[model samples]
Target: MAHIKSRKHPAARRLNCSAAVALAFIALPGAIHAQQTKPASAKAATEATLPEVNVQGQAQSYKSDQVSSPKFTQPLVDTPQTISIIKKEVFQEQGATTLTDALRNTPGVTMLIGEGGNSSARGNISMRGFDTAGSIFVDGMRDLGNFPRDIYNTEQIEVIKGPSGSEYGRGAPSGTVNMSSKTPFAGNLNAGSLSAGTDKQKRATVDLNRKLNESSAFRINAMAQDSGIPGRDVAKNKGWALAPSFAFGLNTPTRIFLNLEHIEQRNRPDFGVPTVGLPGYYNAALAAKGIVPPSKVNPKNFYGSTSDFENVNGDMVTARIEHDIRPGTILRNTTRIAKVQHEWMATAPSGAVSDGSGSAAVARPDPNTWTANRSRQTKWQKNELITNQTNLTTEFKTGSIAHTLSTGVEFIYEKQLSKTIAGAGTMSPANLWNPNPSDPISGYALTPNGAQSKGDTMTVSLYAFDTLKLSEQWQLSGGVRFDRYSTENNNVMVDGVRTRLKSSDTLAGWKLGALYKPASNGSIYASVSTSQQPPGGSNFTLSATDTNINNPNLEPQKATNVEVGTKWDVLDNKLAVTAAVYRSENTNDLTTRGADPGQIIQYGKKRVSGVELGVVGNITNQWAVSAGLAKMNTKVVAGSATQTGSSLNWSPELTFTAWTTYKLASGLTIGGGARYVDGMVRSVSNTANAATTNMLNVPSYWVYDAVASYNVNQNLALRLNLYNLFDKEYVASLNNNGNRYTPGGARAALLTANLKF
Candidate 1:
């Protein structure tokens, strides 16, 4: 008896009730694979075909064979660097929510938009070319501020790449981004989901787990979202999140885990769209002499200030413990505490003028009322962050060599309060070739002209790491870290005169690596690392000149990286490929001072050289794939030749990504993907300013996405997602002198209903 056929519709008798619990989980996995291939009778196949039990969990992939990093405990094809992982069912089948949509499945990762026009929930990525939003992390700790990140209790994200300074400590010479929460197991799982599409999207998510007794356990995850940001205009986004977890002695051997998290956000800020006569211009011979250019706006225009606003709040607490003290030795501990808050009010755009016989270019609101210019400005900010971390891990062996160890200590506290109000008012810029958004001008006000700045910081760090095998295909690893930082700053004026500054520093970082396997799924590696930063390395402010950070001849800003890599685990291991070639350098940097004129020196130097390729998991078993590629070359050999050979402002010298999925036997599943970048450089180079030349580019683009699912039973499921499928409008982010720009989100659709019990 084997009959399983069902595909009826009339809206499946008007679904609802959570699509009838997602059609019984899309019909219980095709009715349990048709009752395990029916024909197995013959008295149950003459009994006894048993005696083949091989269960070694964790291996179900769309890429991600293994990763639970606290700085590699092996398996990621044998980790030596260049990690990626995405999981969480590939951003829940691509209806991704935040973390820049799961970093678009990685390829030289990117995202930058938040030049303080506020609210993308902070964390403005841009890896490999630096600016790693302070290297992110959560679970592995450090999740400072700049808000906006939710993957509804994410269960995987990784990243890792270059430098990583001995596994974190003043990172970002291009690397870092962890995330990995979602715990409590001993299962009895419960899941939930609901979503709606288009610019008026709405979302809800929940995941609950329980199992009290026989070891103890509990888990909870929640999220809520309200959206709108298709073609921009009045851009909007709202958020909510909560996470709770607890576990005690699960599976015994002494264990404990606890977690708590809360997040909130309110947004309405999109300071994008405008780049004077666009299209790669480095003053194209001053636009062939006639100038002109500035008219086809409408990527859903909405030039700020409709009561601009952005607010975010976050909190976290974590604790972990493990103990075995025998049988292969084990002991682990983790601790975390976090707090964050941010506030904002923004309205920006100020550049563009030229309109007398050079034909056009008008953005006037006041430059004496039109020497041909456009204007708008308003800024206000507040930020606070607190962090703490503790770690210890262990493993042991001697004699035949084998070791794995980790030790950590960290603490950080940061505070910032800022306000900027210049010339107090200006608005009314339209007509760079016909414009009018109800043109009106005046010194628009949002208050806060109190000019103030306050900054505070404190940090303490100590770290150590080790790994070694030394046989059966050798292995070795190393790490070291130490830090001591301090800062205080205050500046206020608007007639309330005040100024203060202080600084302190101490730093060191290191790493080294080697590995070789040859077989057993292949591996080959080489590595070197170093990192350092001081002088308020990225905010925590400090300046009273003398070369900043309260001078004393300030110093610290060094980097070095050298890499070589390879990893393979073809078919039988279910895919997993990797490759790398690298060179990274910084050597101080902090130019100027070619003999005073504001003094500052650091013998400059910059370099980047790259090649990377990756692939992940399943090539069969219903197919699944993940892909990446990157190519790079950046230089500045000595420094200041207007950036010597250019290449660093949002660096992008090629990138690529790919994703795949397939499954069917009636339980349906489908997928598609694409992403490409290449075309960057829009600032940082001052050959005395020829508009910072290198042709001021940004171009290069490609995007595409699609997904489908059905499951109808076993617990219900249904999904559909599509994004920028064909409406590639381009320009996803830009800032750093090329006057704003953002764009990039034009086609959208989403529909989901999932339920599991």
Candidate 2:
């Protein structure tokens, strides 16, 4: 078993933490002095005064001149056990177009680049030892699908680690990511950007907010992009998105909002990268033998073509209503409806095959020989989800006790339908692989003709929570929840047979927590939480050629998580730092055990321990930075033996990211950062063959990105971004099919312009 040992001493750790706090203390006074001394520039004066939009229910800090602070990002921090927020400014500076682009550099997340390549279906992002599995939310509303996420409507990204049963129902033991929308403001304003770079990359985005009245407003945002292969021949991504929003406020005590978003994407796929044994190792040995393997292999020929296909469309509608019942008491209700559809297909390399006699070592490129070739696979899915969440929160003072109580009931209904069609190199007579390079690869099917698997899922939950102030400096919080779920799979028969079944289950979860606020701006906390996941339909099997893998006799994957953390704002709020230590165990773990080449049984038990550290603040008025580090050790304590000690697929043991921005002048900013992930393994198999063992363990890699922007005026700006700055080559995920996976290309750049009119 390989484990990472922490070498820092107790006292040293404490001192480093103290230094961060001291630095924050020094920034407060300096910032105040700067605000009082610097005269307003003409550019700042040219922008009109706009109504404030406070995300945290605060007012004063919502104005144009102030930067969002810990106070403004507190709601999530206070409600969830662990939370992290990535601001809009950071996204713009990074030119993030996908969730992986935004999360790859996050401390606790490592995105799995699937063997299917760049144009293949989007892969998964692991957080705290569990997969995201299409479990994501927009404006605090649940939406599940395999669709890739684009950054057009994103205002901010927030990640909450650990069981979220109190809010999100029946999710993985890991965590969830929430995306906030760009809201409407009472003013005439605009912001947009444009860029063109490598791989023939081009992009444009525009945002507009208008006021309908003192109590009503509307907002619209649009994005478009066109790009080509930045690396291998078969990879490409192109898409566009449009989002419109509206909000109304009858008075100070009541307000309501509605949002509608739509997106469309067309992608050219690239999945596998041929492995040319890296530089020093293979060459030296081969040279000594007076024989050398080619530096690179194309893995394709005139008669063997590789390509990817993609088409995606989605829509979402969300609404929120809130009423201030009294001084600190409020009543709120939120609801959302969403739909998503996707169709994707791609071709990738399959490992070498030996002849029947076992003596033939000749290069096998023809489909008829069965030596080496690419397999074509296709997957399509459609999803619909609707959630209605209502809560009543009351904060009141009774004698010496201050209490904030929140009671809520949430119900969510989700349904998904999907089909997969897969075929090998030799299928039909017309699609036969040409043995000769001079022949054309025509009359062949780019996508295989296969079978379809369908299913429907439903989940219902109810929960309640309360926060009690025990003393001036101490508080206690606790919550409990109950859930019910079920799934039914309808199979499409091959020869006229009913091969399907259904299953359901009920579960409960709870959390207990305590906090000590030594000062108004610092908090030390400890919490114990529990979560549950319904029996997924794919866990069972009933036959050989036909599996009765419908939802049947399956149990929920459950876990208990214990965590300790602290949040401190030093230097009078100029610097903020957060650190945590956590241990989690899954009693009835969910895992897969292969029954055949393309089939598996899913079930198990697992345990994990980890630590996290983060810092976000201004080093000085002219400089700002945010950085984080995370390390975890996860083991299948009790489960299918094959997966016991293997590094969990996308969950890397060590992950780190950092960003720094330096203000060059009155209105100019430049910043750059890097994301690092220690190598990882994606799968576990029973055999010792190279394809089965090595395909699961992918090596480590690093990515670098940079940005530069200038304010033309208070309401307008220009910017440029360079991504994959060095074009580092690496693969994201691999499987036993003898196919190696490869991520997208490198060394690309883009330019953008934003205007507020």
Best by lDDT: 1
Q: How many collisions per candidate?
A: 21, 14
Alpha-carbon lDDT, every model = 0.69, 0.61
Model 1 C-alpha lDDT per residue in residues 1-757, reported as the tens digit of each score: 2111111111001112323333432343334333343232442444456564443322247767676756566778766777888988777888788887788788887777645433342358887777788778776666665666878898989888776666667766887788888898987888999999888988899999899888988999999888888777567878888899999999888899999888887887676756654576443334445544433355666666565567677777878888777664556667666666666554555334533322343233332322113445444556555666566667787888988877778777767776775653555665433334445556655567677788777778888788898886888988888878777888888988888877676778888889887555667889888876666556555666654433424666678888887777666556677777888887666665343242345667778788777776777777787877777777777765456676777778667778788877686888888888877776656343443311366788878888888889879989898888898888888766565577888998889999997
- Model 1 residue 142 CA deviation (Å) reads 16
lDDT of 2 at 737: 38
- Which regions of candidate 2 fall more than 4 Å away from where they truly are? 1-80, 113-120, 232-234, 276-307, 351-372, 397-399, 420-451, 537-551, 590-603, 640-646, 684-696, 735-738
Give lDDT: candidate 2, residue 111: 57
Best TM-score among the predictions, by candidate number: 2
Candidate 2 lDDT over 231-271, as tens digits, reads: 54435678999999998994558989888989998886555
Model 2 RMSD in Å is 8.7
